[model samples]
Target: MTAAEAAADLAGGIIRPLFRSGLLVEAKGDASPVTEADRAAERALRAFLTERFPTHGIMGEEYGTERGDAEYLWVLDPIDGTRAFLTGRPLFGTLIGLLHKGQPVLGLIDQPVTRERWIGVAGQPTRFTSPMGGTAACRPCASLATAELSCTSPDIFDAAGTARFDRVRQAARRVTWGGDCYAYGLIALGLVDAVVEGTLKPWDWAALVPVIEGAGGRMTDWQGQALTLHSKGEVIAVGDAALLPEIVSLLS
Candidate 1:
């Protein structure tokens, strides 16, 4: 199987079981909640990657980092929203991305509870598959004039995030709250027009980038900067090209 396919299968196999069994949850040093499920999921994914692509490097949230100078690296976020997952919300997901020469080339966000998977490659069309065997071709929103906007938390920005949030809210025709990584997944699915967030970690934003761009959306730092693995954690994603300039200008 291709790397992307293997990653997706690994994610599914890991998350599906914990989500079904209702595992116990706990917290990490950052105060972010974690569960046995989260660790198990990451371990499974790491083991799969190590065995299948032994030459590749790996970075994961729970286990810290492992290095391999090979041309390819795998980045994993076993459970993107442990807070939501612990609460039994279906918004949580498994995020996996492949970095080729330091640039993400493929990404997968699998919502095991929802049985929804959003998969894409850097230059490919984003595709969505549901548990019912239904599939859809996705693209970024085509119209800025009547676009919808979303974000993870209204509080990510502090004063700056609030200001940027206000600008986006004022510019968009509508705004919906409450979706973490799931918001970006919606953007990839062409269901949401844009998403703005702040104070994210690499694992938080890396996987979403390829999926969003592959779906024909634009993702950048708040200042309209290119998103790198070392970005400042602020992010803006838009489906409409025209809307981005306006959003950026207003945030500035």
Candidate 2:
């Protein structure tokens, strides 16, 4: 099976169960929520990669880094949006991305409760599948003027952030709240125009880069910098390239 397919299956099989089981959840030092499901999901993904793609390295959120020197690496966030998961919200998801020489080639975001899978590969079209087994070809909506905007949290922005966010909000036709990792998935599906967030880790944003860019959107830091694995979390993804300058201006 392809890497995208393998990731979907593994995430659904191993990670989804934990969401359903009501596993114990705890807080990390940063106050982010984590659960047994997160650990188990990463373990399952790591084991699968080891056996299937033995030479590939692995990096995950729950578990520390391993085999970092390999030519290819799989970055896993077994559960993104653990806070939503812990609160019984279905906005969380399992994220998997494959990087070749520090560049992402494939990405998969799976929402177990919703059964929504968004997948993308470099140089290919992004696609989304729903729980009822319907599939659709993804495309970024035409322009930002007609676009809808969204973010993980309004509080992500302080007074400065709030001002910047308001600028983008005013420019858009509509703005929706919540969806954490799921927001990026929506951007890939052409359902949302942009998603911005702050205070992110590598795992939080890594898997999302390819998915958004592959879907014919632009993914970058607020200042228009290329997002790297070592990037400090502030991100702005937009379907409309022309709108980016305006959005960036607000952040500036």
Candidate 3:
């Protein structure tokens, strides 16, 4: 937790100043956006982690990998939602995750602009605090018909994935879009019931597992299997565990 907190502090310090400053945005080979804040925050985080745990492996969105074969690996996405940050939305966050032999065991989501943070450690309840005030608990919904659902964007889905996602969207009581990592945090706060997304990288969803599960929710692939480094990017997260089977069935 200390390491994750320090990483958040370092990343936030770099990110907060650049939001909406009209910084130059470049497109990566995949066409996703990148900015100086993302690169700088990640560089700072990598340096700290390297000094703090010299033998631990590190994988970052900005800078690829170092010591990838270590038993303890740190996964990072200094700015998880570059689009949101560029648009001056406080919904973007810094993600820091620790994987033990490829399984996530500790994670954090820090929204510096909103002063909101959520920490999740394996076998412990997720902790959350925000100046706006909310508890780190998920609300129960009797059925998908009553669930409030969110996805970062429908465009992330391919044709088949879109069909599957639409099945859940139609059954859900309401659907919200473009939440990015912030949507999963809402599930931890009991403000959102479920989120389904596709085309995610490990850094995109690794930290999310502990946060949601520690909040009495479940995070898994659409097939209902636990998420791991090797799993496909398709993901389904629900506040109510009972909802998992139904959601999996729908996606299947």
Q: Pick the candidate with the highest TM-score.
A: 3
- After aligning candidate 3 to the native by TM-score, how far in Å is the CA of 85 from where it should be? 0.6
Q: Cα deviation in Å at residue 252, candidate 3? A: 0.6
Residue 115, candidate 2: Cα error in Å is 2.2
lDDT of each: 0.78, 0.78, 0.93
Model 3 clash pairs are: none
lDDT score for residue 202 of model 2:
74
Q: On residues 1-252, what C-alpha lDDT tens digit does candidate 3 reach at each position?
A: 998898899889999989889899899999999999999999999999999999999999989989999999999999998999988988899999999999999999999888899999999999998888877998897589999999999899999999999999999999999878999999999989999999999999989999999999999999999988888899999999988998999999
lDDT of 1 by residue, 10-80 (tens): 77776776764667766678778788877888898888889988888888898977874668878889889
- State the displacement of the C-alpha of residue 90, model 1, in Å, after optimal TM-score superposition: 1.1
Scored against the true structure, residue 204 in model 1 reaches a CA lDDT of 81
How close to the true structure is residue 30 of candidate 1, measured as C-alpha lDDT? 70
Per-residue lDDT of 1-252 in model 2, one digit per residue for the tens?
A: 276567668767876666646577677886777788788878888888888888888988988778887888888898888888877789988888888888878888888788887777888777777867644333545555788888888877778778877877887788899988898877766678888788777778778877787777888898988887777778988876666777788788
What would you estimate as the lDDT of candidate 2?
A: 0.78
Please give the TM-score that candidate 2 achieves against the real structure.
0.89
